[model samples]
Target: MGRRSLSGKVVVITGGARGIGAATARALASRGAVVVIGDLDVEPAKETAAAVGGSGHALDVTDHAAFSAFLGSLGQIDVLINNAGIMPLAAVTEEPPETTARQLEINLHAVIHGTRAAVGIMRRQGSGHIVNVASAAGKFGFPNGSTYCATKFGVVGFSEAVRAELRGSGIEVSCVMPGMVRTELISGLSEIGFLRPVTAEAVALGIVRALEKPRFDVFVPRRLNALTRFQRLVPRRLSEWAMRVVGADTALFHGASSAARAAYETRVHG
Candidate 1:
């Protein structure tokens, strides 16, 4: 229940090659944890792990057997961070079914796979922590991102229910909801003044803080939670209008990749 130290701890992170995952690896390593980065990009994973004086492996979180095997290879795991995700934006009706499925697989299914593996190790040891890197979209849905929202919302729900189920098991589960962070995932977008993405390092700090002081929910900026909750309290119409005025609806739309647009077109017209 009190603060915990990372010294000599064993931490495993999915999608740790870059972005928030890479930053979090560095943060945990600095705290004396032995970090292991798992990512599809083998070279980058090795590079990141080396930078943090840890180890890296090529991992596809979607592969249940592989995920389980990776954890089994490690003698013990003190912490597991489910940070792998993909965001493909398109109108609900226009979204490609394949893309939607991939989104759900990565953002939601992967968490379940990784958590199951980690919980097994943690339960046997009687002490562990799991950090799920969900997005603010998990809390509040935005237009043109129905599938992404669905996957993240699923994560939020899964994290809460599991945290409650794991009570007194010496395992803590924390759901991290970050508004926006500067990452390659959204590199095409121009920064909006109010919805500007926080640095990946800042989000990493929040993750480490959550680890030390276990909490069910963690917001990167901390204050973003208030705004998100307030939006839910207000009238639906007001919330919709507020989001539009703040450019939330068009945020990812404007920066959508060419491939995304083409997928939507091909799926709809074909």
Candidate 2:
């Protein structure tokens, strides 16, 4: 299919202050999309938006009323990217209840709320796209990241069901599953063989491609899609062995105590 033009499209991105969200905002703007950034960090979000000739707003995605108001303020919504999330690594048993709740609220519930709001607007217009940023951990569980993995897994499943629901409504839904990305989210984490960390720009490009082509599943580095498919068909024991070989089993566990991750961990924990 021919690529769709992003020119003049009004795209709304949550968590656009940094990382993949900021990268995507710049990329879509380069394609002539009028990007609107919404982040908890209003100052940085505005800075990013100013650089791209877009606009920024204070958005707390976890609050339904605030999220709805933020979207409603936008005149037209061509695309909505639910990108706000936090990852606080810890063993499932050792994880605090507050930490688990925070992850669920930010990572999964917020996506759900934003998607539903976008659907209402898109249904009225009869055209739109929703991109949910999940993770490769959503496809396979890893040590010391059980809650984080659960939230991502929920995003993957939720996106699939919503995609099916919106099949003929002219509103496309994409689930982005990226491997360990070179962002603060993966600070202090070591690369696991060939599953090395991908750049935030690379993930942003995958999102851009999804917008242009309207694909349902978007995997950064692209190879992860195939690997995940293979993992699904293999025996459980074999898949477990493969994970061990690639160091996925202990990457997050070791990263938890790394001094490099202290600041990011502190921010997320608070």
Instruction: Point out the worst 10-residue segment of candidate 1 by lDDT.
Output: 261-270
Give the C-alpha miss distance for residue 227 in model 2, angstroms.
Answer: 1.1
RMSD (Å) per prediction? 3.3, 0.9
Query: By summed lDDT, which 10 consecutive residues of candidate 2 come out lowest?
Result: 248-257
The digit string of per-residue lDDT tens for model 1 on 90-109 reads: 78888777888888888999
Q: Which residue pairs does candidate 2 place in steric collision?
A: none
Specify the highest-lDDT model's number. Answer: 2
> Which candidate tops TM-score?
2
In candidate 1, residue 130 scores what lDDT? 94
